[model samples]
Target: MKARIFVTLKGGVLDPQGRAIHHALEGLGFGGVNDVRAGKLIELDLADGTSDEDIDAMCRKLLANTVIENYRIEKAA
Candidate 1:
């Protein structure tokens, strides 16, 4: 089975890297972008029958920093 995790900063958290990217985009003449948020995508290959609970645990334990970030799990085909 393949699992994909999306980790992103929580609201109210400062994101300097995202801000820099947004500025660079505006400098390149890419307008209409009001705000930008950056995140990470992690793809995992797991043995069959891995339960959702296990995946969730992975996110909570190490994949994401719960205090400052949130994560979503998706099962990939």
Candidate 2:
């Protein structure tokens, strides 16, 4: 089983790093750059029968900062 986690900043959070990245992209002549936010991706290969509840626990404990971001889990065969 494969688990893909997407961790992203919640709305209304200030992301200075993302802003800097956006500016750099603009300086490089990338057009149409509007807004930017940074996030994380975690891929886990686990044994079958791993529960969604357990995965949610993992995200809450270590994979994401609940104060600033939210996480979503995707399971793949």
Best by TM-score: 1
Candidate 1 lDDT tens digits, 1-77: 99999999999999998999999999999999999999999999999999999999999999999999999999986
Model 1: residues with Cα > 4 Å off, grouped in runs: none
TM-scores, one per candidate? 0.97, 0.93
lDDT of 2 at 45: 92
- Please give, for residues 1-77, the per-residue lDDT of candidate 2 as tens digits: 99999999999999898999999999999989899998889999988999999999999999998998999999999
Looking at candidate 1, the ten consecutive residues that score lowest on lDDT are 68-77
Clashing pairs in 1: none
Q: Model-by-model lDDT, in order?
A: 0.97, 0.94
Clashing pairs in 2: none
lDDT measured at residue 39 in model 1 versus the true structure, 0 to 100: 95
